[model samples]
Target chain A: MMFFEGSEKKVEAVLKPGQASLRQLGRPFWAKMVAQANAEILSSIHNDDCDAYLLSESSLFVWDDRFLMLTCGTTTLVHAVTEFLQHVSQDALAMLTYQRKNEYQAQLQKSSFADDLASLAPHLSGNAWRLGHLDGHHNYIFHLDRPYCPEPNDATGELLMYHIKGEDADYLRSEGQNIEQIRQMMAWQQLLPQFQFDDFLFQPFGYSMNGICGDRYVTMHITPQEDSSYVSFESNLPSEQLTPVLNHLLKVLQPQSYDLISFNMACALSHATGVQAIDHAEQALPIGYQMAFQHFLLPSSQVRSADPL
Target chain B: MMFFEGSEKKVEAVLKPGQASLRQLGRPFWAKMVAQANAEILSSIHNDDCDAYLLSESSLFVWDDRFLMLTCGTTTLVHAVTEFLQHVSQDALAMLTYQRKNEYQAQLQKSSFADDLASLAPHLSGNAWRLGHLDGHHNYIFHLDRPYCPEPNDATGELLMYHIKGEDADYLRSEGQNIEQIRQMMAWQQLLPQFQFDDFLFQPFGYSMNGICGDRYVTMHITPQEDSSYVSFESNLPSEQLTPVLNHLLKVLQPQSYDLISFNMACALSHATGVQAIDHAEQALPIGYQMAFQHFLLPSSQVRSADPL
Candidate 1:
């Protein structure tokens, strides 16, 4: 199978009080914007507080005054954000944050984070930071330089797992796997019973899902190739709910290593068993958010031994 | 500066007896083949046993019976090897080996190792093996399936250093650096006084050198960017000479990690100070070569701490 880049480029933006409701921009407009990134909107679901899109590459979410867009593969996501900025003036934005997980095949990407920063410079000013080693798993963040207050409930947690193992992982890689079986494998019902879910199983392989519960949401994207398996789980739920959700996914996927990221929230996976934190860093973003990142790996004793020559 | 892929694609082939000596093929023929890979022949050096050409990307060594070619960047090296194979019948090759180091930017390349293997399959039957994890530093090898015997002294050692540090590395990256300064910095005069050296210092930054002493040869390539610094030292010298050379380079480069690769020779870096082997693998190739690979990294305490976020 050809390699597919599963890591995502993500953007989170909050509109000013007097701005037009983002939901009112309509799906067609958002579809055009997504197309600018070389991705398509497969389908979308809506709740009273949000609109969650299931994209051909990843997912996008829209609320009255804020939205989040994430796309994977070789999508030029910066172009999509720039297109959106052309429609909405910078004065209409209260806060903006863009993030990119270091890619498995970064050279395939149409633009680097630095390139994206240059493209976005015309519309808004921002500060960027790289959070980990360039030789290993890392992340890049670009946020508007403006400062502001955050809602007590404004929090996000993301868990990115790599080199997954076990029968479940094999099943995901196997042919004839379906969405219902994957949902059952993930056990989202037990993990987030309050949310309503929508998911898609791609031809041959891959999976994506979006769940919405009033204002809070959880989304997942899975690429299960044996050579470079990866699964990412993200949620806006409080830490108590998010931590268990992350731990549950880790138990089922059983990755060799994983990274936990929290925005305006505390990371609590230090108590997880079997894995040790290999790297950790935290930053108080200028845009009124506390960002913490921690990478965990199975201890050498627990990790699979190297194959004998 | 834009990121350049520092990893190399390498090819080694042994021609049949009574065939024209590879050196007799002349610089023009080899230049055409190198041009097929989009690299230019800068200059060349010769000794009794080999003809070494310094290419814009890396190096090439041609002997009467065999030739070794290496090139980095986004060059389509498989094309060059394929071009050479077109002129030399498969029956004119007793043995052949193709190798590729895991690239820092794989997707930028014109073809993956698998693609190269497919292209080569038409020219010769071969067995391919991966020597390490796909998610980290690894190598891919494709060797013709044929019984062979090695010369008593048929040995090679290669040292690949990553994330180099110290004032020497900074000097290599800085503007206005010259070939003489680099030669002194690398200390080849002390390290291999017998060998005659020809080196190049790339504009902006980078270095490549080829040294020849009778039949044995040593070559070096340096990509000294701060974010993704790398230096590689390779030689066909015996283990005793090769081991000390590697240790001296390690001491001068002060890299965070490095890989020692030995062919028909034992790897002897287990006692290197400050670093420990994180991965090791070995294999007996069908073509009468024993290959061993070891990856070493500084202990956590010695590696520079993470940047404060």
Candidate 2:
């Protein structure tokens, strides 16, 4: 099978005060905008604080005045962001951050981070920075330069795993895999029992899910082909909760290498036993958010033997 | 300074028996084809075995029956290859190989490897494979699947260094640098004393050189911005000579990480002290070439502290 670009394009926007609640924009409006990105809303879960969407490609989380949307594969996320900007007053945009993780097959993407930045420039003024090495694991981020303050709890953590192994990983690549089996394997209920989940298993392979627990939400997307397997786990849960959740996933997924990223908070991961940090970078963004990134790899002895190509 | 895609696009073609010698194609003909890629031929050097042209972007080498051309930056090398194929009789083609190393900024490229493959499909039948991880250092190769034996001495070695450090790297990035100083720093006379050299020092920063010794040739390209410094050393010299040249380069450049690739031969690099191999991959190409790739990184302690972003 051909390789898929599992690394996502992510856009998060926090609106100005006195602006209309994003919820009032309605599902129909959001779905139409998402369609611009070539993705569909598969399902969604809601709580008092957020509307979490499990999309055909990835996930979207909308709060009262802010939203986080992520899409994978070759989806043109820049189009959706452009559509959203056109539908809203430019004056109402208080802060906007667009992030793209380096992809396995970047050339296949419809737009590069540079293309996206140019498309957004007409709608909003911003500055961009690249974190980490361009030849290795890295992230590109563009954010509005205006003064703004984030909430104390406005923190995000992302755990991106690569080259997964073990029986659980095998099941993910196997034909008999299903949503329920994956749920049990992940043990999300035991780990985050309060969260409600909406998930989908793609035909042949791959899986995606959205989980909401009060204002905090978590999402996971998996592409489990033997050659280029990848899993991404993201959450807005408190920093303390990030460690256990990340540890559990690492234990289950058993990836050879992984990256931990935190926004507006310090990453709480004290490297797990066999894992070693390869590179670490921290930057205080001009837009008032503190970003930290660390890439980790398992010791050679701990890594599972890969099948010959 | 903005980052340039130092990684290169390479194309090699072997002609069928009874075909006219490529040298007979003349400089004007080859220059026209290189122009199709938006690159200019800056200078050239020749010996009994080959004609090596140093282009504004990279290098080109032509032998009687075969040619190897490489171009970097955003140049559309596929276009140049297409132009060359059109000039020659299709019936004269025996085998063709196209390769692309993963770039630091792939999204900036005019065409992806996949796009190049599609463009060449009508002119040549070939199979392709990716060596190494997509998220890190990797190479995409497309080759005609036909039986052809390479001479035992028909081998090539590439040493691609990233995040270069030390005084020489600093000189390369500084304004006071010159071509003669670079040549002395590289000590080509001591290393490959028999080879004749043609070199260029780009304004402000960077360097490129072509060295020819009889039938063998060596080329080096340097991009030395502090954040994204890279140096590429390639040669058709015997395998035994490869280790010393590569070792001398690593000692002088002191890159944080690097990749060593060998075609039709084994990579003879024994791990130097403090350096560790992160990954190694080997494959026998359908076109009768043995390809081996290894990625290595210096211990964290040995790496120079990078300037903060």
Candidate 3:
């Protein structure tokens, strides 16, 4: 399938300056009113493609909702395109190709980058990301002890964020065995897709390769705006005597304002521990202290999903 | 990756004629336990490679508690394999492939009809045929009623026996809604493999020609066997109402032994009446069974599952 072969796109998004301020917007109904929320969700999808994308903007109140948190990062045009076609079963490429021809220059044909991205406009509105949760709990600690990967330079700009819980523990006194397995199982679902392109056609790639397909949890992959050459990001966290879990994220990323936003209460702690533990050895937070980026709360900007071709 | 493709097979066996017999000779747990029944069941394959076959043996239970039914069906192979490797994966072909190969000549290549059957010996065992169950009820009833299918003089020895419990009154009221569907679905699964060949790998010309799948709660393709001809079979039942069902089968198959089986058990009737209506038109029965066969009482026999090649 065309999907199996790595797509023909090579161009990356240009990260512009300034904070992409995020905020929670006022809504007519309570988030807990699932019945009401579902009705709105359906109506939005029925109104045409754009309505579905914008509904999230207005619908989002609990920035910490696991489903919302997974999509916080800047994503690639390629990932975005695939998600839309997969979810909606639409002929996305054709629409995007038409749009690309109408707006971009003929020379762009030298590369498929613009074409690939244009196809994704249908799926991404102002935000492009997903949510993550494990064992009904959002916070799970993890400690990374492995040495930095060699030639890690090429892998830069590539961020590997892992969530570990159970087996990472030193002792299996009670529920330890099951707890560790669940977390690893959850993390595999979150991380593996970024590496595998073949499983896209298969139904969730077996039970082992997937988190439970229940609506309770989800994992996402985001393509950031920068490459590793310009910027790099990494994190380190605490280890334990028994449950030796220290959450860490290493980013070999290009420098830029591009970012991802999603709702995960644990993400706050995972990053916090990493920063605190890393600081125990050296350095304070990056120079600026204006404020930490609040992911769940996006500015009430009424940006619509990219117009459908 | 290829294994993920459903070329894998199930140990399949077909029911031959005569009083149920037992084969005491112990062999590979699969074939040995499959008791030597007077009825002969053959090995059949789906797809080009006869990986899995089917059988009509009962689940493990001692003949009143002697030997165990060690022959594992689809669930057996998949789970055992999962243990051997480390995790259960998805089906490579379809969910399951039931078959019994007659690998008469598992070695040298032969072009004749005899040689072709020999290579099959490695794949199919004499008493193996896969049974695909719906929900979990093995005793299923399908009503087949069509103006008519073109009748030919000769029998297409390949036949399936569906036992029904409908009384004369019930038979008259039968709309045959289910019978037609079950036939179509089973036929399609049998014909569906052709498209898997090299030339039509992407588009399924076979499915289109067959006109099946995509529908729900329809007929289910149960099993396939190696024996293409009929052997003499017997049963004792004399009834006039049953004539239509027999006549119907005669055109499609040369049933060696046509029989009916039934018993009176209290069952509720009427979706609206909400009361247990014990009407003489006994409810429905399994997909392949006649009334005469029901009159005869037989003990559960052994089941042996073998790897048909």
Candidate 4:
């Protein structure tokens, strides 16, 4: 739920009672209204104008401009949307958006997880177009079927992303920067590291050469996954070789080697635990890199700026 | 903060220990390590593999890596950005976002707020663009001077919002039906009643369109402000007033209203809130000759039905 108070202090004061607690039978009906004498003065919504930079997929619904989350399960679209509006008002920040897989028009033709168990097979060799739903609300939604993705996890598969809002997208369309300018300034090549997961094994997979929708924005286009054994390999990696390579890399790369913050965590997490530290951090830091340049193996005795190099 | 523990749960369980303030910080050496670790984590230096979506302003710094936020006396660009990231990450949603902003190259250009005010003699608007440097994490920031559009609080004299993120933004862009489709479907020539604030002296004078940004998603553009009056005059109505009129209409016309769960809330917030709820609702929704049917309103309430009229 997103609650838009003017200042941080006002936000804190107004959202003092704000929380997401699971209720008994129905949805979590956390109390939204917190009226107190000392409630921080906020910009009045009345007569105040709000302008939103929206793409085409954007639609605004009115439901008393409230911020609550109990509206997630409205069977009827109207009730559901009204409920979402209320939730949006409360905390647009932490909303766990959900929709029935079969309910969406786009998903109508798609087979169910059970019905398409054979279809749920992972891609082995080549690539596959991954059609994961627009991940979800700013909340914790759990337990979706394989139809969502061949992956095992729930709600946490955003390895590839696109730009949908802001000047970056607008500039890409309006200003029309040349390919050289794009390549040099933005370093578009380095943005996303190329890795072959079970979903896509194809090399040099370009994500939206042109903007995805009428030059409005960009998109991540992965090679399609045909019949394959994602299970044979651990997670997306082929367990036969990757496990050892990853383990070897972990053994060498140390934290505290760099002044840069994330690198320090890498060293710290590794030092704090062991090889497991690198594995543990994958959830928070999903992208990994080469141990030589991306990371350094610095033992404490000889741990210096030049030591890793 | 929103730790999405997928396969890396075991790793997360271990790395989570370092966050314990008391145990780690009790000793200076460990504290330094912890502080360093904290900084490292913030910097995003580790090129670990996970599905992370990041948004950036400047390509100079591939924040796919991380950086630090250190104050340089005055409120510089660096300070603003650090504060912005810190604010967004306060919630797990923002931290777990597939989207992020990058302005690592948006160097720390410090300008005193007092200095900005003291130069009021010239009343310069040329430097309005400089205000963009104030906040680093703002994905699509548009800063303006005060007094031009007042009453919405003058604290920062700026309005910044991050609208799209996660899959919501992706769907907004990648989908076939663009913004125009939704707009045409929703905004079916909504003719709204004359809107007012209190009496004839004060009323809404114009309609404004604002594009609010999230991560990759764009919400429909709509923002209408009420224009107040000090002197009496015989003024004609505004063609610009159409924005709000259409906004109120588009919201009330959503397909969710017809659904089983939403009819009530749909009927509630759909009616504009004013003194005497019953009278206002009555005027908005007539019994037999309902304004919904007689005037500018969508024919069908079902989003799937697609313009029944």
User: Best-fitting candidate, measured by lDDT?
Assistant: 2
Candidate 1 lDDT by residue in tens digits, B196-274: 8888888899999999998899999998888778888889998888887888787778987787777899756634465
DockQ of every candidate: 0.20, 0.31, 0.01, 0.01
Error of 1 at B101 (Å): 2.3
Per-residue lDDT of candidate 2, residues A174-249 (tens digit): 9977789899999988989888999999988899989998888899999898788889999988878877888888
Candidate 1, lDDT over the whole model: 0.82
Clashes (backbone N, CA, C under 3 Å), per candidate, total 0, 0, 117, 73
lDDT of each model, Cα atoms only?
Answer: 0.82, 0.83, 0.20, 0.19
| Model 2 spans with C-alpha error above 4 angstroms | A268-274, A299-309, B16-18, B90-94, B270-274, B299-309
TM-score of 1: 0.86
Best by DockQ: 2
State the weakest 10-residue window (summed lDDT) of model 1 chain B. Answer: B300-309
lDDT of 4 by residue, B1-309 (tens): 111100000000011112222222223332232232122111111122111111111111112212212111112232223333342332211111011111211112122222322332232221111111111111111121222221211111011111122232233334243444433433423332221111111011211111111111111211111011000001111223323433343243321111100001112223222211100111111111111100011121111100000
Residue A237 displacement in candidate 2 (angstroms): 1.2
Chain B TM-score of predicted candidate 1 relative to the true chain B: 0.95
Superposition TM-score, candidate 2 onto the true structure = 0.93
In model 3, state the lDDT of residue A192. Answer: 32
Output the worst ten-in-a-row residue range by lDDT, candidate 3 chain A. Answer: A133-142
The DockQ score of candidate 1 comes to 0.20
